[model samples]
Target: MTTEKCDITPNTIVGDLLRDYPELEDKLIEIAPVFNKLKNPVLRKTVAKVATLKQAAQIAGMPVAVLINKLREAVNMEQIQIEQDSEGKTIKPGWVDKGKIVIEYDASLDIENGLHPAAKVTKEITNLKEGEIYLLITPFLPAPLIKIVEEKGYKTYSEKLNENTWNTYIGKQ
Candidate 1:
């Protein structure tokens, strides 16, 4: 009888990978600077500040720990600021204050208008405040979204995904 070769291709579920190799789980999340080096002008200009090390890792396709360390280095070098509370207390880096201006959108509207929901929201938010701080909340925004936000007169601190939506913080610069 001829022997049959058993298929051993690893299943790629997130949970399965995490359980099988805990070390790699963290490493898989780090992003390479090369992603930033994309030749497309749109990709090159679409920048986002991740709220958590894990997020950065996911975006970078690297390990979470590595992303954390890298972010720490960036903060130390003053390339990014470690925000604090009004009382001069060091709050967690990812935390955003409540009641901060947030933009919400209807996905249906975007689909009808040929616009991404996040981009629509950013445009509306920017119109509301010309030179002020506003926290943006959405799922995953692209270059068009950022361009709209900037044109509306706000600068972004970072872009984040929360509960299947994309978000970013903006302020007047």
Candidate 2:
């Protein structure tokens, strides 16, 4: 009887191996969580619909810092859309569409207050919109706000920031 050892080192190129041996693709997919931490966005995105930096790090079996650095590189390079408000006043952190609302995380606000002021501000912005996609940007926002936005049929997107604080955008042209 002969026994062949399988190479399962973290450094192994799982994607290349799977590509060469198509049959192993299923097995690779089965253990996707392990490969996700490999700092490969192509692999990570293919496996998970929504992968956070922490989750990616766990999948690649690497430090969070390394995964974050890689994610930053993977983000779309296209310039974000900017537009003016009804008054034509410059809106800082403005989006391309007024229908799209963004809520930034703010650590300075008191958590005991039930809801972060930024979240409230975001809610108000959402109210102003007749019908538009709402996107949220923050290192971390109060959970209650997330539910409120969802209940209103607004789309939410969480963005990972370089720092711990949150920033909000009113309107900008």
Candidate 3:
């Protein structure tokens, strides 16, 4: 399942990219120091598998189009133009008021134990009533989990508190 150079786009998963072009791993970290986490075999096998280049760019605080184009150029592929996704969570949504947060769970320990927190977080969010917010704390952006909750019709907001802490607020729409 090698990815062709021409197919290197925002939708490409980080694991796929590194699997197809291991040489690009270093280039990725060079592009964004945050990508150094890829060096961990556990994360490379877990998070990278589900994280698309677009999400990776967002976590790195860069433009998805720029990240894709840079990787494209590295592989000798022509640059391209792609619209960025909305600048989500830049401003906290109204539903995310701290007073409305009824549940707060930190999944950092689970992540450190090589466990995925989707099911735990999902169950908690599923129990959320209208106007209630669930706060999920993690060591990194829980991109995959966020996508799952969003598909279930939940509005979400994520804020990075530090290099290793992310707060994701989920509310029923």
Sorted by TM-score (best first), the order is 3, 1, 2
Worst window of 10 by summed lDDT in candidate 1: 5-14
lDDT values, one for every candidate:
0.43, 0.39, 0.84
Candidate 2: residue 24 lDDT (0-100): 44
1 or 3, which is superior by lDDT?
A: 3
lDDT of 3 by residue, 34-84 (tens): 899899999988888878887798699887787888898888988987854
Question: What residue runs in model 2 are displaced by over 4 Å at the alpha carbon?
Answer: 1-107, 110-115, 130-139, 166-173
lDDT of 2 at 86: 54
User: Residue 146 in model 2: shift from native, Å?
Assistant: 1.2
User: For every model shown, what is its TM-score relative to the native structure?
Assistant: 0.37, 0.29, 0.64
Overall local distance difference test of candidate 3: 0.84
Best by TM-score, which number? 3
Candidate 1 per-residue C-alpha lDDT over 3-119 given as tens digits, one digit per residue, 9 for 90 to 100: 442211111222333334344433433336634333344432344221223333444544444444443443342233334455422333333444555444435445556755664
Candidate 1 all-Cα RMSD: 14.5
Q: Of models 1 and 2, which has the larger TM-score?
A: 1
lDDT of 1 at 172: 60
